[model samples]
Target: MSLVLHLDTPAWRAHLAATCADVPGLVPVAKGNGYGFGLDRLAAEADLLELDTLAVGTTPEVAEVRNGGWSGDIVVLTPWSRHDPLAVDYLADEQVITTVSRLDDLKLVAERAPRARVIVELLTSMRRHGMGPGDLPGVRSLLSSPQDSGLRFEGWTIHLPMKAANALAEARELSSAAASTIEAPVWLSHLTLDDYRTLTRELNVATRLRMGTALWLGAPNTRRTTARVLDMHPVKRGERVGYWQHRVSQDGWVVVVSGGTAHGVALTAPSPGANLRQRAVTLATGAMDAAGRALSPYTIDGRKRGFIEPPHMQSSLVFLPGAATVAIGDDVPVELRLTTARVDEIREVDAEA
Candidate 1:
């Protein structure tokens, strides 16, 4: 069986509603592989929640939200460049908010999208895009022009690295600079609970948090994935099963079940260890896990099972000592991490006796 994305719609949505409930305003980031749920799907859900707007990673994904019957503002995180002509048309007709980083990029938006909404992306530690503090004056001059060019300067944007200490403090500095530069709102990422409260008081302007992960896929450890155990058999030491022809180390059950590299099982990443070799070890481990969506915590007889060997392309072999208690066509829960199995298909089967 191939991969099937098992979606717990109500559960996921409820979690999202609760996490973002505290914030006065929210701008859900619904771009870039839709963070595994696909773009249109995320937009539809965002629309249902009646968020202020939906943030996308790139311009192409705008169509995804529009196609989903969303009429809210489409905020593109990518900096506006003269390279893309369509930016003008979208800005003119739709509620598109283009993020401008460089002065030239801002000029491009002004020239092409004279009547467009723009957000000045300030430079942060990530250094992806955004005008630095030094460039603030130039940006203000463009906006302060007498003609105004119908350029609606709504706010500024900045993306911070998650899990970084003093992330909020760092953001406050940028936010302050942006606010001092213009009277527009602030759009940001990589902020913590304290940062929100502190900035909320320090910066007196409309602010929108362009958040994902925490808002949509928080506590990834809790989510579960599963597949059916297709078949099973007994094998002894020195016996070979898989096409690789590797000998077994012990007399354990040679269980043939569903799942493989295609499902993103064995695919894992290295841990944050002290040495380069330690980091390399994690990367190598992730490569195999990704290859064979090996069952890390697959449910068997209402209990999870363990893997015998690395997973194959389309199926995984598990050492099932409880195979007798369990049976064929049983549901196996695979506890999946969204960071690893962010976007994947899962196959579920009817549980058997």
Candidate 2:
């Protein structure tokens, strides 16, 4: 019994091919849990797509991509620091491009390996990483002469914030600012399909879209997540169970499913949106939390059930109403945020003509 992710290979291949056709210069991002498909799988997929570049989050991820036989240029999305000497050494590979957000990092890279491959990240609204616009002048100067810095300048990268109001305008503004500093293409993320198309057409500079979610999880029907029903117990009202000894208010079935926090099941991440509607949803969720009746991602008999308690490390306890029917060996479908899910097994079915 395990948490499993089944991929409709034909559907995914078709979808990925269509996405590649739609977005030119698309660099598939392979990082962090490999967007639930695992990094090696995605890297292999990217290679099959014959893409020229693949972006990853860290040096370890870079190694994973390469080990998966992706010989194309590997761009490290995260910024570099002197603390990571091994990562710096990895960047020495001509095919690996390290992102440098701070000028100090650029200086450090220059000192360590002047001929190191580099991509300068311009600070965006996210403010999580990247160099400010003012700092680009220093970046341009340091890398302006090969004799001075010896760094192989790649391009500028800007990661936009999610659900931006005027995303196109913001992109235009950032592109203009960055274009003025470096005469290189822009590597971007978090743009909608329409935004991606528009930016490619309207912007004078070349743009490369670094995408993961939309490319991989864009087709939900093609991918299925399921958990096996390991055991089941019938309970009457006020029966105590689970580690917290959470009591049932009514007669129901406690279905012990093969998924839990360790599998990234039932684990919640902060909502990326903060709009009024989202805030109201947050309040409603809070009320559910207060009532200890949180809706679970697991579905039984084509209907989602509620968690009896927070999921255990390797399994979960789900409460199904008295009338619900399920067998111990049955596989229950689950809806998961792929970015956060950790599937124990992945089963890929060949596409059908």
Candidate 3:
């Protein structure tokens, strides 16, 4: 019994190929649960795509890609700091490119790993990690005399906000600002293909688009997630069940499913509520959660079921009241957040299958 992610191999590969053709200098991001396909699988797919570079979220993830047989250059998207214990080990690797967002960290890299390949990150609207515009001159001066410090300046990176009303405009402003100070390739994220093309046309220096969700999960029809039905028990009205011993309101079946909190079955990230509709939905969901009538991700008999209580570590008890029938070992379709999901196995099927 497990939570399985099934991939339509040919269709997914075709999508990946098409994306690579459309986006120039595409660096596929394979990090943080690997978009539910696992890190090793994405790295191997990157090798099969024959891409020159792969972007990961952290420095420690560099080894996962290398172990997955990705021999090309690996760029860690997270800014490297001297406080990171594994920084030195990853810095010394020639194939590894570290992102430095702070001036002090850039100097640290020069002092520790002088010959390290480095990318200076510029602060954009995201403001997550990057050096501010005010610090660009210092970076430019430091890179101007690279011979004094053996650090190899690869390029500048800017991570734009996904929800910005006009991402391309923000990217253009930031890209232009960096190019004016120091001439180097610009690596970016969260831009449409047209926007990227527009930016490329507008800028003189080279540009690369780093994509994670758009690259891996672009084809929604090519992937499916499901959980196996482990067991089922009939319950009468007012009968208490589950670890919390919550009383049932009516006669139903207590169906045990194979995914729970361990697999991110019911775990949800906080919604940003950018607009009125989103805020309304969030409020509705919160109201339901407070009432203990939250919906589970599992769908059986073409309807979503509800949890008897909060999910357990490896299994969940779903309440299927009236009419709906499910047997043991049946595959129940699941709607999961791919980035947060951790499935037990991934099965690939050909398109014809």
Candidate 4:
């Protein structure tokens, strides 16, 4: 009952639906530990979203999703490897689409998986995933050869990180170029409402945006998590507790509540009060070194407590003043970094009680 993440699935689903409403043909991405939901569950949620295609990070994951009966097109975002064609074919017969960033890897994949669908990824803002513009011409030449038959060029994909306007702008620019050269849909990422709306009026080609966070976790900031407080303790200024040399101070309550490093309850974002918002997380750890004090999300006797030390792997210590009545089995609400933590459970808000 303690240290569990009670996900508001309905609220999360509604949020995704609302976000994807303006963008037509949204392809929800489920990759990398399923962003903490453990890929399989995210696959189920994506299917529930009625998506025709899902973007995963690897060829191995394709079987995990396909074996579960997810027949949708498995689009592997990672570039193709000549070392593995049989693996790709098994994940997708005609529907599995693999991404290629290097020109040399293209022909190799074609030879490996004769019937594999392939997507040529162009380098966008996130240079980590695609091929540079100079390499595309040669790759195009390789694919157009009458002799090559195994791998078919399905579409183009652009993975633009977090830049809402830039992502759409780059998509439009790439679409104009791809239209003149090849007849294929262009896949995209990190787009906003206005970006898609802008693309609709300017670009003519089919564009599909892949979304993971927006689809599963909803707004990064709006979703709040909660847990139940399991226990509490009374201690003095020099009282000792916890593993290692951790001790209690302030001559107050030694609060042991539900949620910890394991529950996804600790905050990764810098304190909201920080002057610079994004770097606050790193800055906080630095502050802890200077002040010799550690803090975490702590709710006490119904009043939220402040962290007294760095969080333990399974539990954390919160400092509470006297007069607080928080007891064992009492529930506490917390804000967590959804990207981290185990995401032990996903539940509704009504069940938050």
Candidate 5:
């Protein structure tokens, strides 16, 4: 019994090609569980795309990319510090580009690994790890004077917030500011095609787009998570079931399915916004929980099923009201946020078949 991610490889590849076609100079970002497909798999996919560079979120992920057989330049998006021993050791490689967001970090890189390649990250509206516009002059001065330490200035990178209505305006302003301080290409994230087109038209420097979610999961509902039913038992109306012994309001079948916390089943991501609508959604979800009607991802016979209790580490107990049509050994579809899911296996099926 297992939770499996079934991929339609042919269709996925088509989508990948189409996604890359629209965005030129693409730097595919493969990080954090590889967007539920694992890091190594994405790295190989990046190679298939024939991209020149790949961006990762951390230093630890560097080995994963290398193990995947990706020979292209690998850029670490996260800001680096001399305090980090692994980054200090690995940043010396010519093929590696580490982002520096602070003056101290810039100085450290110059002193420790003078020949190391670096991309200076500018602060954006996102307020993540990056240097402010004022920090660029000093960085330019350091890059201008070639030290034997060989600190190679690759380009500039900026992470943008998704909520801005006019992202191109912000990107244009930011790109102009970055270029004025130090002439280099601008690496960006979270920009629409329109935004990219507009920015590229106005900005003289080259623009490289870093994308992850839209690149891999371009087709909606293309992937599915299937869990095998392990056991089934009849239950009486108002009968107590599950580990916490939650009471069932109606007659149902208690199902033991092959998925739980370890598989990322039923785990909720943090809410995105604190706006009224988001607050209302949170309140409604809480209300459902209070009423013993919490929604479950497991779907059987084309309908969603409920949980008998909170999921376990490796399995889940789902409550199917009324007569049980499902049986042990049967597979049920589970709707999952792929980024958060962990399946035991991933089977890539031919789209044509």
Candidate 6:
């Protein structure tokens, strides 16, 4: 028994084809657990779709994508730096396009691997990585030198914040600034289809949109995640159980499901809480956590269950109240964040099945 993700092959492939048809110059991103579908699987899908380029998150991922059977131009989204020990290896490969965000890194690429293909990243409101517009002049001078650094200028890239209200305006302004210094294609992320069209029409340079989540998990109904029930034990009120020996509040069954911390269960990223309701929910969840009681993602009889204690490495102790009935070997539906989740198996089913 294990945590499994079931994918509808025909429906999922149809969605991919539809997304490709809608977005021109689409660069499929297969980074960070490949959005819950391992890199090798996504790499094979990219090949099947006949895409010419794939984008990864780091330098080491270059070989992963290559070995995964993706034999096309692979672009590393993370900017290159002297500190990156693995950067030098991929720099000499023509198919590997390294991202250069800082002036010094650009110089380093020019000095170390002059023949390397490079994408100069411009800083957006995200402020995470990339060179600012003020650094454009230095970048222009380096690339336009008489000595000719021998680097292939791939394009300019801008990664906008997901929740930015003026993402399109920011993209337009930054892209225009970068274009004035050097002419090349503009690669971007987090722009809507209409916004992409508007930017393409306004700018003279070509544009490519790098997409991961929207392209893969956009159709939520096409995929299903389930955890198998491994064991169950009845417990009376006030009885202590689990590693911490926490006392139970009511009579219930301690349902041991096949998922835990190792599988990304109970582990969560910090929530920013954009609204009052969200903040309230976060606060409530925090209170529950403080009380040593928290809700589990696993659901039974259309109701969310509660965890008896912190999840173990390979299984979780869920408190199923007396009203509900569950049996060992039964599969329980799980609401999971795919990007963080590591499932034991991924089963693909045809539409007819």
Off by over 4 Å in 6: 145-147
RMSD of each: 4.7, 1.8, 1.1, 3.6, 1.5, 1.2
Runs in model 5 lying further than 4 Å from the true structure: 147-149, 274-276
Ten contiguous residues minimizing lDDT sum, candidate 6: 142-151
| Deviation from native of the Cα of residue 197 in model 2, angstroms | 3.4
User: Candidates 1 and 4: which is better by TM-score?
Assistant: 4
| Deviating ranges (above 4 Å) for candidate 1 | 2-11, 83-89, 146-149, 219-223, 269-313, 321-325, 339-353
lDDT of 2 by residue, 92-114 (tens): 78898889989988898898888
Give the whole-model CA lDDT for all candidates, comma-separated. Answer: 0.72, 0.87, 0.91, 0.69, 0.86, 0.90
Give the TM-score ranking, best first: 3, 6, 5, 2, 4, 1
lDDT of 1 by residue, 1-353 (tens): 53445655656666777767877667888776566566777788887787768888788888888887678888888777767766656677558888888988787778777888888888888777878878999888889762775688878887887656688778888887888877778887878756776787788888887787777677453345667668877778878767666666567676666677665665655455767998787777567567643345566656555566667777887765523655667656665544445434622222221
Between prediction 2 and prediction 4, the one with superior lDDT is: 2
Superior by lDDT: candidate 2 or candidate 5? 2
Off by over 4 Å in 3: none
Instruction: Highest lDDT: give the candidate number.
Output: 3
TM-score of 2: 0.94
- Looking at model 2, the pairs that clash are 114-150
Compare candidates 2 and 3 on lDDT and give the better one: 3
With a 3 Å backbone cut-off (N, CA, C), the pairs that clash in candidate 3 are none
Candidate 5, residues 145-243, lDDT tens digits: the string is 676436888888989988776777778888899898778899999999788878888888899999998888778656778999999999998888888
For candidate 6, what is the lDDT? 0.90
Q: What is the clash tally of candidate 2?
A: 1
TM-score per candidate: 0.81, 0.94, 0.98, 0.84, 0.96, 0.97
On lDDT, who's better, 3 or 4?
Answer: 3
Rank list by lDDT: 3, 6, 2, 5, 1, 4
lDDT of 1 at 195: 79
Name the candidate, 1 or 2, with the larger lDDT value.
2
Candidate 3 structure quality by residue, lDDT tens digits, 1-353: 68999889999999999999999999999999999888999999999999999999987788898899899999998889777877667899989999999998888889988899999998887778899978988888788788988899889998998889899989999899989987889999999899999999999999999999999999999999999999999999999999989899899899999988888888889999999999999999899889888889899888998888999989999999975488999999999999998999888888786
After the best TM-score superposition of candidate 1, give how far the Cα of residue 255 lies from its true spot, in angstroms.
Answer: 3.2
